[model samples]
Target chain A: MTVPGTLYGVGLGPGDPDLITRRAARLIEGARVVAYPALAGGDSFARAIAANMIPATAREIVMEVPMTPARAPAQAAYDAGAARIAEALDAGDDVVVLCEGDPFFYGSFMYLHARLAPLFAVEVVPGVTSVTACAARAGLPLAARNETLTVLPGPLPDAELRARIREADTLVLMKVGRHLSRLRALLDAEGLLDRAVYVERATLPVERRLPLAEAPDPAPYFSMILVTKGADPWL
Target chain B: MTVPGTLYGVGLGPGDPDLITRRAARLIEGARVVAYPALAGGDSFARAIAANMIPATAREIVMEVPMTPARAPAQAAYDAGAARIAEALDAGDDVVVLCEGDPFFYGSFMYLHARLAPLFAVEVVPGVTSVTACAARAGLPLAARNETLTVLPGPLPDAELRARIREADTLVLMKVGRHLSRLRALLDAEGLLDRAVYVERATLPVERRLPLAEAPDPAPYFSMILVTKGADPWL
Candidate 1:
């Protein structure tokens, strides 16, 4: 009887190889089957971050997760990926799934975890999120004492976004690609434009930190904007 | 004349030693002087996490940062600590300030960074925060697909807490020590009691995860509460 192997969902942190945790590093190096999500044609960012650590003899599984607004297609992709991961687990091969950020924080790994937890022994390893990485790179204190910090997705309606900006003590906007213009206007209306800093590819070689007003017209998908309402003495 | 050495503010992640990033490991191990915040009586949690990696011959500076509601004493402590650190840097000793979680995210390193940035070179290395670590430990997804996640300090007025709880799709309440009862009542008032999960000392050996209702009467200062207002199909 072959014993079922455990499935590990490991976070690789935000783009930098050195940011990978020691626990994640050990698991990635020892795993017999390594899996990561990729676009239809592009390489996996999570896998690329730990490329140096993964053993050459390990079997790789590159699951293609589409980058689309529709949730149905994405759900389908995860379902298929989970099945592939399950096959390896059933075959007594411990599988390591690479995730970009903390697996449970607005991550794609949740889709697989949802399907696989009931059937397999799964463990999650958290990592340095872009939220913290961006704040560090921008040299901005995210919150202090009793200040409230709000994290909003960019696709939210302008009215809700404006309301959140107005009420939040510190603001973080994620997924700021196409919604860059709309977010800029909302921050402007709330008089938070100057307080806002946009970060793209934080902690990476090509990282960019700029005032929200000076950022390019089209922001990258991985970009985020951080706004500290109070005066920044460090800046 | 000795060259002024750069100061490195390194985040040590939540609690797990293996969770430390490679960048942080290198800096901590190679630093000439390592400084970290310590309570008057208790050992520094940041130093304990990296105790294995720090070089035995390195000079250690334990800065006593008071745990008081008043900010004046805290500021004074940091000011004095910064002066002490400056002496090391001025003598061409690169000092590494060890911080738990991301340095800029409500961390003590911010106080030191504000004082030292103008006079000396400082670099911040981000790490995994308790927010993400607790979410992963509790087996809950924080936010996804345009959902707004609000991080509130537990000291807020009940009315304000209730209002933010109503408006937020996902919420994380930090510094949840004595205010656990108040926070529970507010969640109940918002009909979110069942959705709340409390985590203490995440990633540490003494980690605890429970439904908010099941958590101890007096929550530890190191605890946090995560509430997902919407239906979490992944969970």
Candidate 2:
């Protein structure tokens, strides 16, 4: 009987290759079979981050997940990907699944984990998240002392977004793609536009940081808006 | 006159050395002067994480920050440390300020960054935070989709904590020291004891993860409580 091999969910960290953790780098370099999700007909950002580390001789599994509002297509992609990954594991070949940013933090790896964890030994290597990356690039200190930090996705309803933004001490609004204009207006109404800093593709060569008022409309999906209210407590 | 040196605030990730980013590792290895803060009478956790990579010829500045509720003493400590760092920068020697976790995320390095950023070139390297590390260790995915994630300090007032806990979709309560019993009671009262997971000194040799009900009272300062209120959306 062949013993099943372990499945490793490795986070590649934001977009910068230099930000990849040593442990994640080592895993990528040593893996014989690697798997990663990519946008259908688009490049794999996760693989691109760790491209140099992945051995040329290794086999690659590309799960083409469609960018859609519906969940069915993405679920099907993961189901197919999991079946293929299971075959590798059943054959006693460990598979390293690449994830951009932290795996468990709104990462697609969670779907794979939910499916495979009960059947095989799975290990998750944490990576630096985009929240901290945006914070670093903006030179903005997030929450300090007892201040509460709230992370909200920009797709939430306007009423909910307004309430959350109003109550939040320090806010990080992610997935600011087509919702940029609405978010800007909300912050502006709250008199928080001056304090809000917009960051796009943080740590990458094409990264940009500026005040929310100056940010482009329909910002990239990777963009984020960080707002720290109140005086600088550290000072 | 030689140009003033740049000051790098490098995040060392969680306790595990392997978790440090390649950029942070390179900076530490090539640094001529390194600075980190320690508890007045205790060892420096930041320096200990990067001890192996720090070159033997590098000058080390250990700022002993007294752990007191009073802010005056800690401010004085940072003020004193920044003066010494400024001197090193004036002599054209780059100083890498070692920080555990992301430098701008509730990090003491922010104090120094605030003090010296006006005069010196400062760069912040993001790192894997304890939140993600704890999530990885606990095998608990934080927030996903449009779900909101709230991070609160355990030191918040009881009423505020209760209100926040009720409103939060996903909660990460940090600085769970000396407040475990109270937090546990609060979670229990809110019928969330079963959902709350306790993590202490994540990614370290003595790392521990268990249900919050089983957690020790007076938990370590590095401890955290992660609670996911909703059913697994990915599943």
Candidate 3:
């Protein structure tokens, strides 16, 4: 029996190729096989982020994770991908699974890691999360001193979103794509619209940063909204 | 008048030298003058994280930032540090201010950026936050799907902390040193203590991960407590 090779969940950081960590770069570049999730038949943003570092001779496993409201298909895709990765590991071949942002922070890589860790040697390399990237790009301090920062998804019930926003000194709202209008309404009702900054594809070449009030009606899935309540002189 | 050199706030990532971003590595390696915050008469963790990348011949400016409860002295130290950095920028020598974790996420770099942005060109390079690094090291997914994650300072009033914790599906308690007992009490009251995990010096050589119940009464200042509620199968 061959010694099971290690499976690496490598975070490429937020879109910019330069933002890739040295450890992740080394893993991705040296791996003989690299896997990444893509929108069925679409290009992989995770792959794009680390394109500069991935060796040209490396084999790629493009897992087509459907972008839909249903969760079943995504789960199935991860299971299949995990099985495939496990096969390579069983064959004594290390596999690098590229992930956007930090692998374990609300990332798809977690699903694969959950499925594979018990069977094989798995390692996780962290990266710059979108929250930090957006905050840096927006020229705002996320939180300081003892201030609390809350992160909420846009799809949450309006009341819950509003309550969470009100409970914290700083807020970062993710998954603000189709729920942008509803999110905007909630923020407006709470008079937080003026203080919110919207960021899209942060750290990428096509990054966009704007006030929440001026943001597009239906924001892209990759967008984020940050709202600050009090005066933060650093911002 | 000389062309003022840019002031770079470089995030060294969560205690691991290999976690440093390529951009931050370049800035640190090329910088003739570098600055890092250190406790009075103590070593600088930020500098230590990026020690491998910083040029040996670099002029170091170790700003003694007091860790006392008093905030006034800390602010005064930042002001002085910013002034010193500004001097180098004015002299056409780029200065790299080393920061641990993302520079804009609850970091002192923001204070320096706030003071120097108007007078000098400043660039912020985001890094893997301790939150992400801790989550990865702990082998747990922070948030997924529509789950809300709230970050609270350990020093918050117990009532406030409980309220915020209740609002979010996931909680990350930062600055959990002296406040561990109070925080543990709040979590216990909410019946969430069993789900909590404690991480200290994440990604570093001296990293520690354990159940919050088993953690030391007084965790280190660099420690974090993560509490997850409900079933997140990905975790």
> Which candidate tops lDDT?
2
The candidate with the higher TM-score, 1 or 2, is 2
Q: What TM-score does candidate 3 get on C-alpha atoms?
A: 0.97
RMSD of each: 1.7, 1.0, 1.6
Tell me which residue pairs clash in candidate 3. none
What DockQ, between 0 and 1, does each candidate earn? 0.69, 0.81, 0.71
DockQ, structure candidate 1: 0.69
Output the number of the TM-score-best candidate: 2
Question: What shift in Å separates residue A18 of candidate 3 from its native position after superposition?
Answer: 0.7
Q: Weakest 10 consecutive residues, lDDT, candidate 2 chain A?
A: A226-235
By summed lDDT, the worst window of 10 consecutive residues in model 3 chain A runs over: A226-235
What interface RMSD do all candidates show, one decimal each? 2.3, 1.2, 1.9
lDDT of 1 by residue, B75-188 (tens): 788888999999999999999999998898878898899999889998999999989889888877777666788999999999899899999888999999999999999998
| TM-score of candidate 1 versus the correct structure, residues matched by position | 0.97
lDDT of candidate 1 over A1-235, digit per residue (tens): 8899998889899888989988999999998899988997867888888899889999998888788767777778888888989999999999999999888767778888889988998889998999988998888888877888899889888888878888899889999998899899989988889889999999899999999999876899999999988634432
Query: Could you tell me how far off, in angstroms, the CA of residue B143 lies in candidate 1 after the best superposition?
Result: 1.2
Give all candidates' CA lDDT scores: 0.88, 0.93, 0.87
Model 1 ranges off by over 4 Å: A231-235, B231-235
lDDT of 2 by residue, A89-167 (tens): 9999999999999998888898999889889999999999999999988888897888899999999999999999998
Q: At residue B118, what lDDT does model 3 achieve?
A: 86
Give each model's clash number.
Answer: 0, 0, 0
